[model samples]
Target chain A: MQPVEHPKSLNEVTADKIRNAIVEGELALGAKLSEQRLADLLGVSRSPVRDALAALQAEGLVVISPKRGSFVFTPDSHVVDELCEHRVILETAAVRLGITRNPSELTRQLAASCDAMQSALDAGDPHGYTRADHQFHNAIIESADNRALAKSYVLMISPLKALRTHLFTIMTENTDRSLSEHHLVLNAVRDKDPDRAISLLSAHVGHLAEAFRANLSTSQDGKISPATLEA
Target chain B: MQPVEHPKSLNEVTADKIRNAIVEGELALGAKLSEQRLADLLGVSRSPVRDALAALQAEGLVVISPKRGSFVFTPDSHVVDELCEHRVILETAAVRLGITRNPSELTRQLAASCDAMQSALDAGDPHGYTRADHQFHNAIIESADNRALAKSYVLMISPLKALRTHLFTIMTENTDRSLSEHHLVLNAVRDKDPDRAISLLSAHVGHLAEAFRANLSTSQDGKISPATLEA
Candidate 1:
């Protein structure tokens, strides 16, 4: 794969930037992203930004809520948990093949992600931790070496960044626990132990399921700052 | 639960009809579908038909090929096999719950779909068989009782119908084999055997994968008749 990373046109770049913003929750979930304001922010025309919005909506990252206009598509706790379940299904299948096909490099890559995770945790910034958390799992998905699997994983989980950021805050409070899971997962992958890797991954995704439910149920109780934890 | 099937709007129904036409080869994969012509054929305005086209494009039944305009997305055999692998990931997960919950009515519903499958098989028309195949899997997915699962399943596979239909013509020659496997799958579900159901379902989907691959080789040998077999 050649670096294929560069977009030929500014529209593509703008679309991706907006898409990442939607994913990382620089844009609010269910918030209507004004096209004019976004164009101004991006220093581009409304046409490209609108095109970007259409692209994101097509990806289901944004919902064109009929006459009301386009807003970020927020998955409630139930959908989030379902996505986690979907993750387990696809990722488990991936691990069955991925760990066998490549173990040593997989371990190194995951360990690298762990380094970022630890740094983000120490920084005590929810946003940094959120991205690091994404990269941590991303290493495994990429290791799976199945383009379709990786695409589905990203498409299905892309909308959950908000909820994920919220959960990362809770996990950051017990910082060591988050970093510890990475070590266990990396080791499982390194040992070429599919079952252990899958179990660890499943538990990792499932724990987020339960924790998010708890947060959704009681986020307004005032002990935690919602802004600090916003997905 | 009461009958949960929501009545689709005219545009939605039109989209389904057009999608099937393209997928079943009534409209030929890669054949351009003119909005005005389709609107006249369906006795609807181009506006709704355009909306339908957009919807089908989202579903992937149609490709709005840039500049050249819209055409039915005709996937080759390689894409078919890959798409089947995706279905395996989804259907296997669905059957896990299908057997785990042991819902009695679910059996009867799938039984009805099985009967329809038999009728389609007896019809011996590839197009009819393809329609039946769609219904059969749609029923099985719904039996899984998870909306997110169903949505993900459609999102993953719907656009790839040209490939699936191309695969269907080859697999229909083994209709009895497929039906037998379906019976085993249904039996596993009825037995409240999650493990068995998942295994059988995985193998069933795997059969489709093989069939998809077979279509490619058949095409290379010029054994596939686009007209008669594309029925």
Candidate 2:
């Protein structure tokens, strides 16, 4: 993976590099991650690579088996389904809390995110669009003003993002429709209708759930590796 | 803080000792946790003490300041309110999901836990009662069959248990009421009514929130510390 940004420490830089590589699908599912091989590939020492692997293990993107060493997380269909359901419950709750606490401010932030997403779509920048999409949801979660909610949401979604790396790339059927859904959620929030906002948010996450299910069905061989058992 | 059980590893034993101390009020809020001091207190070495502190930090029971050593978490009134709100949202969602998926089996498990809780109370063993209480809620979360939900719920609630230690000791006035509430929730789940289960679970957690609020109001110094800011 190509290094994009300079982090404060070499360990952090190595970790982010490896994280980006996994999320961008450069590292295939269930692929073995030898510290030496990664160090050689990234032109870094094995110490930093080891630290990076440990960091990835915490983020749920990598798993270590007792005898088999580390591998990229390769969840089975059942895991994916559970992850999707968890996401729906969490994101819906987040949006409802967001609407309840600060309707006008949350609406304004989401509207700005939506505009940025639209611009990215128009510019044919899927990477930019994805970044903005992540920010949009993060803003909604933060707006809830609940540290525990936000922490739990992050812990649950981080692994799902790794699972979605390739699926998101392939599920390019309806950017325009997704953008419109965002606007609808913003409108519901702006109107201070928590019920409507929650319904829209559920449907929005439901769309991702469908895509994850479809991807899982099409890719039958991507079973959970032995390493994931430790996780 | 006395060692009750031998864990599989030294790190685990050290972590459990510190966790128990914090929860049982042997370690006070804002109390500095020097690695050397903890090691000496626990009759262990500094290495394991440091590892234990790191593990406790992950559980939200300990915080490491930039300049100061680790300390027990000291959440103020606002943080307690947010924590209670988060618990209500998550546990209610969990009960609803549990009701939807495996009502009979979940109801059976919760009933068993209620029996265990009653037995503990009859024996005048508050610690045993607390353990059973935790298992009861854990059963509900796991009944949803979502690993991520269970993980998130554990992550969110682990810290709150510290706040409950003292509150639970003093809030003995409603033991019978809480027991009856658990039975009502079990009945609602057995009846396959998600709404009733959610409402009962919400009220059940609401009682804790009320107690926490009352405690915070009476004890003004029990505020979120600078260490918690670092957290």
Candidate 3:
């Protein structure tokens, strides 16, 4: 028999709410998070909000300082580059394992996720598109059927989704290119071409770093200066 | 200048202490943990112990049930297989990145770690050897110079180490083979041969799974039965 699920504690629920807000870009990058404000907004007590922030900090989605207060993570070009490189390593492994162990499932899931992305893009729904995009990549990780790998992916994926949201909304990155890349990778998966799928995925992830670097170099306001990115 | 480090909170310290205890096999696998007893032993209040267990639970080093108390993670054959596969993926990526980005540093750190492991084996210190083994693998991850990847590796390393300790003490798995495998991988790394290093490391990790499976099949007590390995 399937085990019964326990109801999430208030702290867990609060953490999920704040995590979604950050990943969905409702909470702006590097925005200060006031415990009282969050509690008021979420209709919860300060204790749960405080616990949630602490939990989110552990997840790398929030930053807490003793003197300065908590803030959403802000990734600069260097952070973006490292994150992209890490994503490429993980997703490529996921693709290889998925194809080796469960090619049919991976292909089916990718096709479904790809269709969702197309629908979101056609509807001009950035939120929906981003969610679909998240699921599309997650399909590859999930198809590997390794909980350890999936847990690791989940830890890093939020910041990536948040960054994608930032790129989509602020940078206004071309969704059409992303959609096309997804289709190409999906087609390669369908063809059972691990090398082609991995190469395409690597390039696709690399483009985000390139875009971030290009944007950073051209910006005059020093919003995401290289100095801030250090460590 | 390096950023000043903040002192770890009571919860963080408690978590680290408990984590080490588990990883070192001082705390037996599947042994129930009492917050009160832990707090007393650690000379702290129960609150910190409670918080620490929650944190450890998040790290996959501890399991907390609504009815049953927290326990150190106990990996069965299937769990060992999945963990080994996950390690192979992450460490191979680390090997490639280390060879590409920081070969000299990787070689230096690995040689030192290998020497330490050899000394530990010569001295017949299982704990020291396991610690050195941990560092040897960590050197590869650190050389990759990717904090995101390193963080993911840290999350999964504890349970793996605990299993290694178990193998050493209970299963009495041959340490010589593990050491020779480490040296083989190190030699490949020193030669800057990413492909060879990764292949050797993959096989080395795969052996851990094979050992766990072999031991599980021979045990008549059902201590770590396949049923317990499920999720």
The model with the greatest DockQ is 3
Q: Give the TM-score of candidate 2.
A: 0.84
Over B1-231, each residue of candidate 1 has an lDDT whose tens digit, in order, gives 897775777767788778667655566666777888788888888866876777677665677744457877666665565566678777877777665554576677667667777887777665565666667677667767776667778876775565665555545447788888878877877787878877887888787777666665766422223332111
Instruction: List the lowest-lDDT window of 10 residues for candidate 3 chain B.
Output: B222-231
List the pairs of residues colliding in candidate 3.
none
Q: DockQ scores for all the models shown?
A: 0.41, 0.48, 0.63
lDDT of 1 by residue, A1-231 (tens): 786564356667887887766555466566667778778878889877766676677666777644457776765766667777777787787766678778777788888888888887778766676677778777777776766567677777766665665444445344577678778988888888899988988887777677777776766321222121121
Select the stronger candidate by DockQ from 1 and 2.
2
Q: Order the candidates by lDDT, highest first.
A: 3, 2, 1
Cα lDDT computed for each candidate against the true fold? 0.69, 0.77, 0.81
Candidate 2 regions exceeding 4 Å error are A1-15, A35-55, A170-173, A220-231, B1-14, B37-51, B170-173, B220-231
Worst 10 residues of 3 chain A by lDDT: A222-231
For the record, the alpha-carbon RMSD of candidate 1 to the native fold, in angstroms, is: 5.0
TM-score of chain B of each: 0.77, 0.84, 0.88
Docking category for candidate 3? medium
User: What's model 3's overall lDDT?
Assistant: 0.81
The Cα error of candidate 3 at residue A197, in Å, is 0.9
Assess the local accuracy of residue A71 in candidate 3 as a C-alpha lDDT between 0 and 100: 89
**lDDT by residue (tens digit), candidate 2, A9-114:** 7767888888877776777788888887788877889877876776577667899664468898886777777777877777778888888888788988999999
